[model samples]
Target: MLMPIAALLLTYLVTLALAGLAAFVLRRPLWVLLSELCGTEERSSFWTVWSMVMMIALPLLFVSWARVETDPTELLQGTVAATLTGILMAMGGMGLAVWLRVPRADSL
Candidate 1:
């Protein structure tokens, strides 16, 4: 039981690092997108930070839910691809959330 939790924790930390790096690389794009969506400067900053956190959390959430066994080797194999895929998945989620929350042009 402890080992499973430990493995998950390790996966979470490593993925967080990867996600942080990805966010750092893509910060400008994220900032622009968040700024467009937010009505105020304060909210833009809030959303910018929140989106980065979401990007980091998403992969860990998926892996935790899907894994039946916590094998670190399996997790680390092809880590680069996994990290990129994770970033994309997180960005997709951010898009979906914003789309759902935003007012439609048709409504205005």
Candidate 2:
């Protein structure tokens, strides 16, 4: 019913918020590491893309490591789907943010 939908919506919102917050906090460090790995000091699309990708991947890795104590149910499946969707959405938003942050040649 509506209750189940509401629960799923809540789960999605919570997941999106937490993942986005984590991405926001870790963006700078991630960019630095990526820039070093790529051996580039200047801003480039490559670093921003990889940083956003890692922002999504790292959280997913953590989630994959977590063990669920309860048995699988339809609701649980729905929740899982919602969570994944939210994570992807958050990553998409992060991609947009980073794209904006990166300097363009035309702007320089």
In terms of lDDT, the best-performing candidate is 1
What stretches of model 2 exceed 4 Å from their correct place? 41-48, 57-108
- Model 2 lDDT vs. the true structure? 0.57
User: What are the models' TM-scores?
Assistant: 0.62, 0.44
lDDT of candidate 1 at residue 88, scale 0 to 100: 89
lDDT of 1: 0.72
Q: Rate the local accuracy (lDDT) of all candidates.
A: 0.72, 0.57
- TM-score of model 1 vs. true structure: 0.62
Model 2, 1-43: lDDT tens digits are: 3364465455445455666676677677766755754567665
Candidate 1 per-residue lDDT over residues 21-105, each given as its tens digit: 8778777786776687787778888888888887877766665555534565675653445656778898898889878877889
Q: Candidate 1's error at 100, in angstroms? A: 8.7
